[model samples]
Each structure stands twice: as structure tokens, then as C-alpha cells.
Target: RQHNLRIKVARIFNTYGPRMHPNDGRVVSNFVVQALKGEAITLYGEGNQTRSFCYVDDLVEAFLRFMATGDEVTGPINLGNPGEFTIRELAEKVVALTGSKSKIEFRPLPQDDPRQRQPNIAKAREILGWEPTIALDYGLKKTIAYFDGLLRAGDGDLARLAAQ
Candidate 1:
């Protein structure tokens, strides 16, 4: 059975940055701390899986805009950056910024992971006039600094296996 109700769904994609689970192991945060600690960065499969990330700030703005719109604007909207990056590239950037001795390691990709995941935000651009301004490098640096602080203050290893 289905209720005859109207609603809008925002299909948000991968988001990253600080405040993320320290031992999340969800790639971005994982790679950041691993690089900071001079550890091996893990990549699944061919490391060609594409992903577009939006900072929390940008995501909040997008949500606000979506809420302000009228019923006519109700949509299956996509809120995320269009800038795509491969797993390998992301790992390299983290290593570069942190100046760590981490190396890249590849493993098997997970089941049901999309090979490509860039949001076609043309609709958002034309409708919401929203696009990500914070470059990945800048965002990653901020995240690295956040983790560095936690590590320096004796917060303990973020990726400790038992911490999960």
C-alpha cells in the first residue's frame, strides 16, 4: 500500500571532512589520518572508483535552498560537488599535504560500489545556483589539521582496530 502524499527527495552523495568518525574507515577520513601517521593507504580494486565530495558547509547551504523553494521546486535533487576524483588521486593528495611516509596499497573493491558517482548538478546550478567553491586540496588540508590536533593532544590513534 502507498499513501498519496507528496514529498521531495534529495539524493545526496558522499560527503567528507572533519567531525567525521575518526575510525570510520570510509576512505577520506581513513586516508587522512593514515597519511598523517605515515601508514599505508588502502585502495580497493583498481582504485578507479569515482566520487564527488561536498564539505558540510556547502551541503548545509544546499539544504537551506531546497527548503526555501516552493512545491514547484520539489525534486529528486542531487546535492554534492561535481568535481570527481579517483581513489588513487585522493590518496596521493592526502600524502602530499601531510608530508607523510604513507604508501598506496590496493585491495579488492567492495560489492555493489558504484564505479562512478559524480552528481549532474546542472539542475542545481540552474535552479539553486549552487556549486562547490572549496577546492579538494583546501578541504583536505583543513581536515588533516583537525586530525593532527587530535593526535597531538594524546587523543589516541583514530584508526585503532579496537576503537571501532
Candidate 2:
């Protein structure tokens, strides 16, 4: 109010979908690319760390909805799916969805990586009436298909680089 400007905030969580950088080093992209290339899926810690993934399309929809809200609704709302899953679960799903023979390889958990991460989207639901509708399985399949196409289109080098 000091600046007399209207502002809104949305705390976006992990999101994945088509057109994601194949080597972004994020979990979703990492797992999808590895599975598609038949490489080992690398997991840090025990792979039990939990995260809630929102599809890009769903997140984008929330952005539009949030922006259309009245100025009185200025908020720092959480925009993410509340359906949480373990990192191992996500890696296994990617392997199964892609029909890859990749085995999971565990390493020490990275320093400062949270053991669990989930969004409390109550504000989003009450304010924007928004929640993600895409299931992780469905979204993973779409991501796998996207990476599969990318690898097949001579981007395999990039995928290989990511694995290293």
C-alpha cells in the first residue's frame, strides 16, 4: 500500500509437461529423459522425499484465473496439486510408462533438499476456485511421450549429457 500499487503472488510448486527443457536437472525432466533413453534413474537419499507435481497446462490455467481476480483478492496463494508422491514412486511410474528397463540407482541425498514438499492450496481453492485436475500418471505419460520424441529427433545427445 505504501507504493500504491496492486500486487498479487502465486507460489508455484513443481510443474512438468511438454516443452520442458530436456536437461533442466529437475526431477520430472530427469526421470522422464532417463527412462526414455533406457538409462538408470538416479535417486538421491532414499528417494522417499515427497513432492506434488502440477501439469504446466493446469498451472497456466491457475495463472489466468488468479490474474482475473479482483484487486481486493491480493494474495500469496499456493498454486500446486496437493496429490503428493515419493520420488521413488515418480521414477517407477516413468519407467513403467515408458517401458524402459532402467533400474533405480540411489545416492546420498543432496544437502538441503527437503524430505517432503507439498502445497496447502486451501487459499487457492477458496479464492480462485482452482485445483489441479491432472493426475501424475497422466501427466507423466505425456512428459514421457514428449521426451521420447525429443530423443528420437536427434536430441539424444542432450539427454545423454543430462545423465552424466
Candidate 3:
């Protein structure tokens, strides 16, 4: 209130879609790229930890809606899909989508890894009238196609970069 400037703060959760780098290290990209290349899908811990994934298109739409709101609508709002999935479920989905024979490789969970991550978007709905419209399956299929094209274009060059 010091300067009375309008500001919007969005606590964005996991988002994935086309144009994500194959080696971005984010879980979605990691699993998708690995499966596409026939590499083991890495799952840390018992893979029971859950996360909510938001598609990029949905996120962008939320941004636009939030921006169109009046100054009184300043928000520290959460933006993401409320649907949650276990890490193993994500890996299995990636494998199925890519039609890859990759195995699931369990690794030790990082010490600080959170067991669950799901956003409460009630404020987003009340304030900005926003919620994600894309389902995980549809988004993942689009992402997989993008990565597949990249892999083919580079003749597995991107895969090498991921391996490095």
C-alpha cells in the first residue's frame, strides 16, 4: 500500500507442454524424453509422491484472465491443475504414450523431496474466474509429439544432450 501499485502474484505449480527442452530436468520432461528414447523412466523413492500438472495453454489463459481483472483483484493466487497423480503413474503414462519399452528405474528420493504437491485454486476461481481446462492425458500427448519431432529432427542429438 506504500506506493499503491497494482501487482499480481501467482504461485504456479508444475506446468508442461510443447517447447519444453528434452533435458529440462523437470519430472514431466524427464520422463517423456527418457521414454521416447527407450531409456529407463527414473522414479525416485517408491514413486508414490503425487503432483498436480497444469498444461501451458491453460496457464497462459489464466494469466490473461488475471491481467484483465481490476486493480482490486491483486492476488497471491495458486494456479495449477488440482488433479494429482503419483510419480509412477506419470512414468507409466509416458511409456504408454510413447510406445516405448523403457523400464521403470527406482532411485533414492532426494532428502528434501515433498511427498505431495497440489494447489488449492479456490481463490483463483473466486478472484480471476480461472481453472485449468486441459487434462493431463491430452497435454502429455501433445508434449510427447513435440519431443518426438525434435528427436527425429536432430537424429537423436537431443537425446545425447539429455544423456550428458
Candidate 4:
């Protein structure tokens, strides 16, 4: 306000969709790649920890909306789907969506891993009139199809890794 610079900040949450790196190590990528490869889906701890996932398209839309806002609307708003899913549920969905012959494998939780992480998108809704339109299943289907294509094409090292 003092500098009169119009600055808007957005705190984006976990996002997943097509074009994601196959081995970025994010949960969505990990699950999708492992499922596509018919490898065991690794779960940390009891797999009861929950997270909210936002489709990439919806997150991009929010970014555009936020950028187009008026100067008076400077915000550090949260931009993500408020819907949450447990890790186990996410792995199950990935397996089912990909139709992979993968099994679930549990391991000790990593240190500093949060038990639950969800966004409160109230500000984004009120300020930018934005919210995620893609459902989890629909988004996952699209993402799975993308990885399937990558595997089919044998494009990158990650693809090669996924095939094995």
C-alpha cells in the first residue's frame, strides 16, 4: 500500500494433470507412474494422511483470474480445491483408473511430512470468483491417459524407467 505497487500473491496447493514430470516425486506423479508401470504403490505410515489436489487446468484458470484483478484486490489468496482425499484412497483411485496390476505397499512415514494439508479457498472464491471445476476422477483419467501415451512413445528416461 505504501509503495502503491499492485501485487497479488497466491498460495497454490498440490496440483496434478497432463504434462507432469513422470518422476517429479510428487504424490500424484509417483502414484500415476507406479500404477502405469504395474509397480507397487508405496504408502507412507498408515496412508491415512490427507491432501487436497487441484487439477492443473483449474489452477491455471485461477492464476489468470488473479492476475486480472483490480489493484484494490491485492491478495495472498489460497488457490486450490478444498476437497480432500486420504493417501490410501488416492492410491486406490490411481490403480483403478489406470487398471494397473499394482499392489499397495506401506512404509514408515517420512519425517516432516504433514498428516493433513488442505486449502481454504474462500478468498479465491470471493475475490477471483474462481473454483476448481474438474473432479478428481476426471482429472486422474486425463493424467493417466497422458502417462500412457508417454509410455507408448518411449520418449524420455522417465518413460523408460516407468516401462521397467
Q: What TM-score would every model get versus the actual structure? A: 0.85, 0.92, 0.93, 0.92
What does candidate 1's lDDT look like per residue over 36-103, in tens digits?
A: 88889989998898888787778888888887787778778898999999988898999999999899
Best by lDDT: 4
Which lDDT tens digits does candidate 3 get at residues 1-164? 89978898889999999888776789999998899889998999999999999999999999999889888877888999999999999999999989999999999999999999999999999988889989999999999998888787766877564353
CA lDDT of each prediction against the hidden true structure: 0.82, 0.89, 0.91, 0.91
Tens-place lDDT digits, model 2, residues 84-164: 899999998988899999999999998999989999999999989999999988988888877777777674786563354
Model 4 lDDT per residue over 60-151, tens place: 99999999998777779999999999999999999999999999999999999999999999999988899999999999999999888888
User: Which pairs clash in the backbone of model 4?
Assistant: none
Off by over 4 Å in 2: 1-3, 159-164
Model 4 global lDDT (CA atoms, 0 to 1)? 0.91
Compared with the true structure, model 3 gives a TM-score of 0.93
lDDT of 4 at 159: 46
Off by over 4 Å in 3: 1-4, 159-164
Top-down lDDT ranking: 4, 3, 2, 1
Model 1 poorest ten-residue lDDT run: 155-164
Q: Rank the candidates by TM-score, best first.
A: 3, 2, 4, 1
Clashing pairs in 3: none
Clash number for candidate 1: 0
Q: For this target, which candidate reaches the highest TM-score against the unseen true structure?
A: 3
Q: What lDDT score goes with residue 76 in model 3?
A: 84
